[model samples]
Target: MASKTLSNSLVRHLMKRGYAQAAPARSETIQTSVLPNKTFIAGVDTNSPVARVTVAFRAGSRYEPQTELGVSHVLRSAAGLTTGCASSFIIARKLAQIGASVSASGDREFVYYTLEATQDNLQDAVEILASLISRQEFRPWELSDNVPRLKYELAALYPQVRAVDLLHKAAYRRGLGNSLFISPKRIGKISSESLQHFAGANLTAARCAVVVVGDNQDKAALVANCLQLTGLGEESKAEGSKYYGGELRKEMGGDLAHVAIALQGAPASSPASLALAVAAKALGNGPVTKWGADNSVLAKAIGNIGPFAAAGFNVSYSDSGLFGAVLSVPKDEANCAVKAVAGVLKKGGLSADAIRAGKNQLKLQILSEAEAGTSLAESVAAQGLTTGNVLPPATLAAAVEQINESTVNQALASAAQSKISMGAAGNLAFVPYVDEV
Candidate 1:
């Protein structure tokens, strides 16, 4: 009797607090603007205490010339090094005073500097970003200091990262094929002058953008602060990238065999790109949990091997893309693992239920990334750089829903017939080549 009375009391308390129904959805609006000089500005208002900002450039490794192979990597490392307006120590001290966090990251096609701090300090953060990118001083001593750091970063590239680099090398041969990291062989060859010239030519208002996500009331101030990006630099001369497939192998000795097999894929602008991503998720993304583990199609196909895992990946560039799987296995079973994966792709059949699950997984992945402040800023910046528009997660979710089993099957078939690029590292005696697979 006493227990029943306590339950009744709790129910009455919840009812008085108005906890009886679900809350309504958010507005989910995304706003955009283009400055007179062509710099793009976009904002996504959210209920986050911390504000996020990104100053991005279209000048990635792909734009580097034949003579200066890794100048882009060097330039990226020089992000916080000294600027004409302030010494490195002053920059660091002022940012720390505001309790701001800063970072730099790049890929083959883009580079960016990101800042995250309390909403109240958003304007200060933007000013610091402007100073860093616009007045960056490319001193020779600083360049020498950063080369060792870059080398250390490259030394830590895992098998997956190395495989992707080799895969791009095999697929494009040049331009996009250029490695994203500094090649140890070409370290001393990259002079400070080349770094300055590259930045002067590519970091123009026309090729750069400022992206922010924070309180709705602060949107006007954010845009005003970013206006500092205008009236600077010259246009970039980015060459078109072409896909030419082949094979590349290295005989580095390691316990496990690392192999990556890729074929031509849909570019970022293609509608089929969403379908391809779903198809990849269905293939495999590693076992979901360690204990019971997942028995997805690709997982079962390679189950006979002693120790192995498969991950489906699709890399989309502005003009070309690569879709394939990277497998790590015991060296002796490498051949068997390769054949099994290829056979599954060649003989494609997926169920409707599987397609539904894969689509949901893809949607969740995209949404989760967007909810994270820094990642959403990067996505907006990349979209603005490429197409001058940003796509909301809901639009991508709807696209994933339209994909069915037949769509995935057709995508798989198209991929299987395209020219193949194979890359392998470690004990390579047993690893299969592209033609053999």
Candidate 2:
């Protein structure tokens, strides 16, 4: 009866600790590790039919040297070009046969390539992904042919998008100030050699991370281990982004004016960043429900400014961040709306109710985004790039829960006291300069 006695004693110990009735404190499903070749890999089991794998690099537009200003944007469009091991036709055919797809996207701080397929077909998807990431051959002819498409993309950009770009320009002025899209002037000027050189310097295998969701961790690690990226170099560390508060305005002569005002925010992965995020939401994001009236402090302050839209915006990068509000209003209402937004930002007050609402809303947004696998994969990969680790939605939500009211108010107070920068586009006659506002 020795084994029976031992089992009885274990049961008694568990009961004493109150572990049987309640769930364990955590069930860590996300796993991250670095391969021998120095590539970071993160995997999570979603138990879903669709599986996704992402290869993310510190090859964003900001990483471009002064000589290669818009190369990252060009590189984003150069996905699926002929690689060393496969032609365009063969890659497309294989992907179509396997019912999989691959796409590329870039931002200020990262370039992401993602492949999606079912779990059973993930191996095939990995092969296709490898060809794209490890064997890119940016041929001269192919690069030239991409110009028209790039021009079309530039033409299709919305004016508000331009306003956001200008905001970045005025904020940091060089590194983080770079645009996410290629400028029209830079199109066709970026050559194959430039693209290859940029990749060789910034998009190295060691500088990237492969993040897989809805798959076995072991299998995903094996898949990541097989990736042999040709580009090899340590990515240049991001230069410290210093904030310069100033104004950038472009007159598009449209009926609506788009304006963004911001203060220097906290770095990514900092408690201050999370606090600032909660403050952004507290300041007001958007309507709570469809067509619902926003009860946000800013909304209540701007009461009935005709035909206008406004929301707080917060984006955090590895070293620095930006937090503020963006307002779009009719030309007739621009003056009044702009002042009201500026006034609200200047106040930067947070209430108990607002903090509770903001924390709850941010938690819901992150959790919802995680359920949509593509966004979650991108997010995890970005975390993997900067922090060298990833946490699941459950743990992230817990983090939100841990942000007390004091912390949120402290971050807001700090940002509010800092000088603000303003960016405006479309029908600028009514929009005031930063000093005027």
Candidate 3:
């Protein structure tokens, strides 16, 4: 009886001091600030054991000049290579010793480098991340060694990705239209000097942001201070992309027809972008649950035609965006499916129940992504870089609450009236062009 009493007392003590493992409180909100040098930083301390920090820059493909088309792809491949202070061997050996990992990813608008580690090791990991982002030294032989990786990534592009790449090309014609992957013709031709020039011109403090998830705001401030890298000049202005409605089609033999038809949508900075996001959900995305066939309106409308896949696709850049749906149908079903999907996009009207369902789904998506550290960091960084302001998931969901039926309807109307652009690949013999759609 005395031993049992002592054990009960010890359990109470541990629980009081937070020694017992438990989920962190969700009441804590996101914190954001900017460094003196103009680098943005944000943090959401869930008081969890794992942590993530990201350094992002407006140094993506859209910023690349006409002379350097594929530098960003090569730049992503160059992560973990030699920096000014540490060799790739040392970076790898030390990070592995600490059991931490880092990654690099990019799109048309920005490039992000993220570091992940246990909460205790995050400070040390930040030091290495600082070196990686600020002290990049693009060596000639090292870049040449990475050509195979570049080729492999490009080779891995299947029909869907190829179609999307062409879709961007048709929509913007340039700038936002730049391909995320290296063009096959430009492979092995991009020079080290080109990369150095692009980095030197674009990765400036004005264009950089640091975002930390799973840690405190003070830690985020420290991380941003550490990344106040100099030497890169002020943000270099890139030519603005104007939407030019056109078609890009690839004639290839295949059983499926992959296509994306779109019109210019609201920019990420605009209030309508969120409603457009909700509309994308309303338009439908295949299946939400496991082992279940899709019940979305798009699926039901086109599913009867043949076995195929259809989903809404919305991409918002800093100043431009694309709103449309993609359809992949058997070549034999392409004629009807393509025209039907395009007609739906151009029609742009949804019922109140559909809008409500879309808002709920989007809210769930936003909150769920916040719980994912990498995605959370990406969201914070992108929001910071593009708008110079960051909204936590909770606040963002609240903003979604402000969106009503009329808001989404107006966004859809605006998009419908915009000129049309289309991209098609894989057995294009049956797919319709923009004019036909």
Candidate 4:
């Protein structure tokens, strides 16, 4: 009877902490807490059969020292390669047996690992995560085994990745970009010792956020297990400087013409972030016909190209942030495309329609993600990383509601007046020069 009551408590705790039924009709809620030295957020959707767990550390390439470039990326890959309990291959096989998936990635500001599995395997997945996080043996042999494969994969991806890297390099060449995050030279210099040191320094409980999104009745035990494994320590107080601020540059080259453009934008917490999103969508996103009617200047300029093969904008926020656009076009139309894009940037600020569309799109995107346990987990984890709290649906909805035409226009005007930088990669020889708009 005591065991049954304890079990019931655990189930209740899990439900309170964002675990929910796995079914599509069920609404999901996220639970947040600051436990000892660590902060955690979880979401549980009981109606679905799949569950997701994400753990993030507020450390990434931005935190690496100049001498230890690419260490974060290397460490992320190595985390999956070997933990004390088993080889990465063995873990993968086990996860597959239970219909689970695991992966990790490093970004400019953070490194994250995720696990997706069914309800029955949640405990196993949690244990695996704990082992990887706390008991991983960063053996030399494991690093040696994975380095060649990592290098090969990076080499293969270089051609496609070069343009994106070049853009970031051009925009943020000073601080963060000079670090490993966007520096190709630094990425090539990653070593095993550096990776181990980086992990040890950054992957502390204080710097971590664990998010569990699914329907699970045993959440209290899961939290307790995590706390025991991670051993809550003092919070990390590492501070870093800003990354970008300067004149723009353009590089000309490659078979498919590429243009990368950036302007100073809002911080993640700023209301302007929504405005920027709306502006990006208004210019070049989704089915062009949806927003880009024949009368729209952007549509007229770019011409109806059926579905855009590849075009999107990113509003990257950190200590500093930028609104950036990347477009791929035929060699002959590259200059035209760049100019057209520039014109859009210069003219479009924000509109009621654009704001409405962006809000709807964002809401829809979030809803769609909720259907997938892995995506839901990632969303919750990412929110924890960025805001030091879970993004509540009500808060999100309120923000969306507050994004009116006036607000969007204000954001757009700010974007237009902000400093601009440009980067390009491909076959052209000479960089294109443009006068300030």
Best by lDDT: 3
Query: Model 3 RMSD to the real structure?
Result: 10.6
Tell me the spans in candidate 1 whose CA falls farther than 4 Å from its real position: 1-27, 215-235
Candidate 3: list runs displaced more than 4 Å: 1-27, 231-235
Q: Give the least accurate 10-residue stretch of model 4, judged by summed lDDT.
A: 14-23
Per-residue error (Å), model 2, residue 256: 0.4
Shift in Å, residue 189, candidate 1: 2.1
- lDDT by residue (tens digit), candidate 4, 33-152: 665555554556556677767777767676766666567767776766677789878877877777777788656666778877787887877777777776667777767676566666
Question: What TM-score, computed on C-alpha atoms, does each candidate reach?
Answer: 0.89, 0.91, 0.91, 0.81
Candidate 2 similarity to native, TM-score: 0.91
Alpha-carbon local distance difference test for all models: 0.71, 0.75, 0.76, 0.57
Query: What's the lDDT for residue 310 in model 2?
Result: 67
Question: Candidate 1 or 2, higher TM-score?
Answer: 2
Cα lDDT tens digits, model 1, 1-437, are 00111122221221110100111112366677876677777777886889888778888888888788888888888888888778888889989999997888887777888888898886787678778887887888887877779888888776656776788889887888888877889886788788878888877777777777774424633544554554454555666677788988877788777777778877777656667777766765665544446466677888755667676666666777777777777889888888887777666556676667677767666766666678777777787776666767776667677877888878777777778887777778898887887
Query: How many residue pairs in model 3 have overlapping backbones?
Result: 0
| TM-score of model 3 vs. true structure | 0.91
Residue 400 miss distance in model 1 (angstroms) = 0.7
lDDT per residue as tens, model 2, 318-337: 77778877777788778877
